[model samples]
Target: MDDKTRVPSEITPDQWTWNVKVDPPFHKKHFNANLVKYHDRVMGQDKLRVFVPLCGKTLDMIYLSERGHGVVGLEFSQIAIEDFFAENDLTYDSEKLDGKPFVRYAARENNITIYQGDLFDLSSEVCGDFDASWDRGSFVAINVSTRAKYGRLMSNLIKPSGKILMELYQYDLAKCTGPPHYAEEKDLVENFTEFQVRMLSEFVVVDSPPYYSGDDFQLGVALLSH
Candidate 1:
């Protein structure tokens, strides 16, 4: 996760990074070109519902919704979710869930609803099943031990025919502090057995704000399908 910066041991990196830092590796000022192109290729112009987990106000939601897709995202941090609406200069209407204290933020201009709550607590009853899901930093951000649980949640959220485009990084663990953890093909297959993991492409980040002593790392983009 871009939020996984090396900081003092006392503070939680994920929440603290969002509170003060805006330059995380995956937080881009503009819509990600890779996402736009990928969506065009597989999803086309259909007004499909797209799920984004651990979504940190990626401008991609605005891009997708403007293209007529319904965008739904889950973010665990209230501050991060609030910052997203504020930073984008987007006016939104928020409503609390039935009995829970959590709120869901909806954009005024597009079909985008972002739920500020835990990923595990989110139900299909709220966001519903998606036609596809975008997992930029989500998989890698989760704890290694919980990959199976994450996989199960996704399997239930995505329709049988739905696809997922996710990002994974491969780095020497000895040299890096991971939350944007290093993952291998076997790990994905072993944990997410319900889906077929097909490696789409790979690229190297030329410049990154390294949290560790390593210079650069490779990012693998994979398509998960049933």
Candidate 2:
């Protein structure tokens, strides 16, 4: 949807928390290929600190951790965090952040930590900073009106020289409304004005899975840096 026609009601943390419990189709049990393909290109460091936004029970966090990168995920759902640990057979210790609206869960043996709370409530003080960030599908999943805010939050969470690896879905706005919104090139540039944006790859698909369907849907992979 375009700026003028975009709806203003952003989905709340409670809504997302509830959605994950129902086994939403968007929840993937495997690592996203796009992430693995672009990992080295987008994230140059082997042992880096990485931030993941709107991270569900994604196996990507484990994938990154296994490769020696420290991963910190910001998610809104306690259910999702619990599932991630249970499915992976990882034991974790939980505690609430002193002044923040989040509970932190850190794996005992891995360099993976997850903060469960509203993304809007996260700050640099609470999350610290990272060398890189990954947005597997979060940019498109959030409301359009909050995109700028989200971008700023990401910018703040990373170091000045940090990089961002993002995956986006693009489609004809007239055909559908989206949780997976149509994030065009211009939208990416505008939202991440502080960074140098590059379109790594893009392709059109006709027969997407039921979770993402469109006649001429586009999938885009991009890398951004300050």
Candidate 3:
């Protein structure tokens, strides 16, 4: 997805870039382990339904399900959702809403649903309110102007006292103009006020297998509790 056309609010669907490709080629086994590590540290509980906003074919959803949490993931692109299931060798049943389709899959015997639709249209009635949110690319994908609205919608989609694990980049503005925006500490604290911010940790691990390659990007993790 190109940075400019991905802005849903500004452009019409036809004008935007819906050309989503398969996610970065990575081993599922390694991806699952990384997700499990994060879940164990941030989620801390089992059997809780997790909401993945703007999930974009991340294998983290599958990892969340394998760990016993039912996963509800939202993606605007159908190609990405299809690619995710196809690469994982998972079978799914699909449903349509006003002509748009969503796919439902079982994640290691746990229910995992991937909705290919507008995030704003997903309601409690459809996916059910989530216990916590596992946000990887969602927050940083939007511009600063839209981050607050994103946070508010996230708070509404999740149950009270919900937890949110957001991934952001800490970089100089000169280097990255970001779809993956570089968020500052103050921006996260103030924007996510509904949730009590506890840890804003910076992790600089050597490019690990499956998730990342050589030192291409520096990342930050924001763990929040609502």
Candidate 4:
């Protein structure tokens, strides 16, 4: 569709389904490097455990695993977890809990494990204490109305000294209202208060994945210290 309707849900049914369907490729095409760069800087050579909230076949997991960091990815959609392994040509074993399956992919002799289930339903024990967090489009997926709840959950679950590297969409109020929801600087700093904000910068980048545009969109990357 057009730029104005690029936001999810507002887009047509086929487009919406396609968006969900091609998550793996979409992440690679659009935002993979940004994640790698951010994580590499924050996580360093510590071999620390990394958490990807609302992970949807994100290439970042592969990047982190390759760099000797352990990965724990949380996803609500089974399709997404399956697609991630399939698309990467990685094989994994599965365990079913309450009729839902959680697929585990271990790398580096079983250091990294990708867990699948409703993000809301996952426990800290399942996710483990993360040294760092990678948030690509996860936050924006929640409606603005529920963002506070999302923030509170993040605060409660995340390790106190851990860091979160997040990407946020900032829209011009007149042009768009979103699922790539608009979030301002104040909101982020306020919402993530328990953690000190280390970095927050805005850049104009292609909105790939859901927004496949050559035109620039405002993207925010913030590093949090708890």
lDDT of each: 0.77, 0.82, 0.66, 0.66
Error of 4 at 184 (Å): 2.3
lDDT of 2: 0.82
Model 4 lDDT at residue 42: 81
Model 1: clashing residue pairs? 1-180
lDDT of 2 by residue, 86-175 (tens): 889999999998877899999998999999998888888998999998898688888888889988988889899999988877665655
List candidate 1 stretches off by more than 4 Å: 1-16, 20-25, 203-205
> Tens digit of lDDT per residue, candidate 4, span 126-203?
555777788887777666555677677787677888888888766544455555676656667777767777555665
Flag the better candidate by TM-score, 1 or 3.
1
How well does candidate 2 score on lDDT at residue 59? 94
Clash counts for all predictions: 1, 0, 0, 1
Ranking by lDDT: 2, 1, 3, 4
How well is each residue in 1-226 modelled by candidate 3, as lDDT tens digits? 1233332333322332445542443223345333555777777766898998877677788778777888888887677777777777777777675543444443443477888777666677667788888877677766567768777887777788778887666544443454556565567778876877755566544343343333546666777788
Candidate 1 similarity to native, TM-score: 0.87
**How many pairs in model 3 have backbone atoms within 3 A of each other, for residues 3 or more apart or on separate chains, i.e. clashes?**
0
Candidate 2 deviant stretches above 4 angstroms: 1-9, 17-22, 206-213
Worst 10 residues of 4 by lDDT: 9-18
